[model samples]
Target: MDAPTGEQLSIRNRDAHAVVTTIGATLRAYEVDGVAYLETFGADEAAPMGSGAVLVPWPNRVAGAVWTHAGERHRLEVTEPARGNASHGLVRREPWTVTAHDADSVSLAVVVEGREGWPFSFRATITYALGDRGLTVTHGLHNLGDHPMPFGVGTHPYPRPGHADPDDCVLRLAATTHLPLDPESMVPTGGPVPITGHDFAAGTPLRDVDLDDAFGGCVPGPDGLVRHSLRGPRGGVELWADPVFGWVQVFTPHAFPGRAGRAVAIEPMTCPPDALNSGIDLLELAPACTWTAAWGLTPLA
Candidate 1:
């Protein structure tokens, strides 16, 4: 197991479950039964750990990993090699501080100051509620700075299907359009792809396709929430996310760092790729405003 790097790591557990809360508003760990549905970096790993939670924020992605704000332009250090975009927000690099902790829930907060291309300040909170089925995560962001803040919130939850083989797993999305990408840098060309390799309009089987693309135009459910889900073969386990999560990026890494290898990453987001420059319907909070979202998981099959 990789030792957590932050100084404020807090571990909580109940029965067969566990939650690792990092000051970074990160659900560093969510475990159910003896199996870890989430991925975590383990021994002999060179990439990152798995089976934990991570937070995302701020102008999610900018063209060329660069952005210009109010006569000022800043270039973010690129974290995504393919597109040269910043990819996930800045919270991933900073440690969140714990706000509250209990038997089953944990809350963390982080303040984002104008850095790189952004020109505002805000405080973000992420709360993870771990239960028997799995976990439900909630996020809240408040603009505390004088200037307006451009922001979006996201979380990376690595879940493990109880089954031994991935061949029995299926991932689904409710998106209607996908952001076309430039092969050289994975940044959006601002064009729409017909949802072919990245399409799951009809709930395609996970085994049939490989993906790492962002899609929008999702159909919101009766509750006014857009949703996405994944199921393991024997129908034993599943996960569902809220509709505010407008875009879903599905990643099937060829050889996951942990476990027996292959794993699927179903990431839900509030906006599509290049939302910063595109001015897409990103979850931006004005000065003194807050934005929030939630999702849950269960097991059956």
Candidate 2:
């Protein structure tokens, strides 16, 4: 039987290696010098908890799965039925066609045709490349229709603590604000507020805190990149995104498939949850126009 995630494409650069799957162009595995940096799953298994899945058109949850565009109300399929919200975006499970592949890089593309909720056509492409800087992922989207398109993009990558105990790892972020979510719906309640205890500006140990939070007001460093990291006794892993990504969602689930401990997901998004309704930092693409952004992971020495 074939792997549930379809083709497993491998790429390498020096001591770093990565596996990208055709399904969703997912990052199934990433490691350096034989040490795992991203929590990985088996080839026969689907992405668990959105692990390494790409989010496009929008990221996070869309309240009630409904939004109004040009005075017309659009209702998306409720993927998160229990919460009565549209979780993630439209293409997470869709198949992507490989456009390029080499020893240290691979590129895949997928087209999102007009559907019931999303009445616009667009093409999305993702390229994963490994180099001395580690792994860089670039995302491109082109509007294929005549109307303007509203969207956000992000990726779920769970950076692991390698051989060190996960509880001993420290998590850090470059964010200065936080978006509070409703306990039931898991949607943002209001606007962003000054980060307090959840402040990860200074590295915080992951031993006791449980986070399923979204942060905004990301401050880019002198390099013009917003960086987040997880460090342990052995080494560390850093995730950085371009300035276009102004929001981030960090999740720490107690249980993850193929894992004995909790896992950390650092998702860099262009907008906050329910941006379809709030319009906060949402991107609008004109007809025949293209939008591009990049984010990456680096294994620290």
Candidate 3:
């Protein structure tokens, strides 16, 4: 047999089941009634295509893997060699501490110590729970250092409706504005721009469209939540987040592990990509202050 994923934890209720790994506190699997909602890989392998990885301290890319803070330029290790940018955040590959677990819920924590380039220590926690609504995830962060910390958070989950080929799925997003990107650097050019054929404000079929874009100007509903959805023939999946999550990234990669053709990644973000450099919607947590945000997924029949 293949080796087990490092320290996997299983949680389930009558409504759903989920597998979480301590490594990166990644969501290894999530299914309802034996139907997979999130594309999953073997436990022995690392997260594929950034599946279920939590991006903290920052999300998406940091252009040139460098940013300026408080008048000092800091360089980060290049995690994305192709673009020479620092992709994702700090803890995706790091082992996290399991603080709590039960039949329907599990919580993991990690500490990020301030290094030379990224200066400032902080503690972060991610909690996952299964319920009738599917899976809910909460991210929390507390600044431990004396100086203020500029940070952002995001989650990468390639959600799919069972049995329906991703190419045929219909995606609907509540966002109105798109963050235009520079073709080469993939960094935002300026403010939000009008969305064209790529728009999902109504509902758009996932037919042949290649997308790796960030969106803002979300039109939240009555409960102060933004909703994005993917619907196929068998069923559908919906991702909703608190208003603090003003940005959502829609990525459709050509091929995904453990899948046939393509996959859709609907990511929720507290800020736009390269926010560290632009200072756009980035959260600044003061010393000893705490920041919290909630997001979840629900299976649609």
Say which candidate scores most in lDDT: 2
Off by over 4 Å in 3: 1-5
lDDT of 2 by residue, 122-223 (tens): 999999999988899999999999999999998999987667666888999998889999989999899999999755888889998999999999999999
Off by over 4 Å in 2: none
Ranking by lDDT: 2, 3, 1
Task: Quantify all predictions' global Cα lDDT against the true fold.
Answer: 0.64, 0.92, 0.89
User: What is the Cα root-mean-square deviation between model 2 and the actual structure?
Assistant: 0.9
| Native-referenced Cα lDDT, model 3 | 0.89
* Clash count, predicted structure 2: 0
lDDT of 2: 0.92
Candidate 3, residues 1-301, lDDT tens digits: the string is 5333468899999958899998888888889889988889987887888999999989899999999999999999889998899999898988899999988999999999966479889999999998767799999999999999999999999887776777878999988889999878888889888788765877899897888999987778887898999998878899999988889999999888878889899999999999999998999999999988899988888
Query: Where is the poorest 10-residue window by lDDT in model 2?
Result: 159-168
Model 3 TM-score (2 dp):
0.96
lDDT of 1 by residue, 39-139 (tens): 66632322253234454564235668887666677778777766667867777657678878877777888887767655677787877777655677787
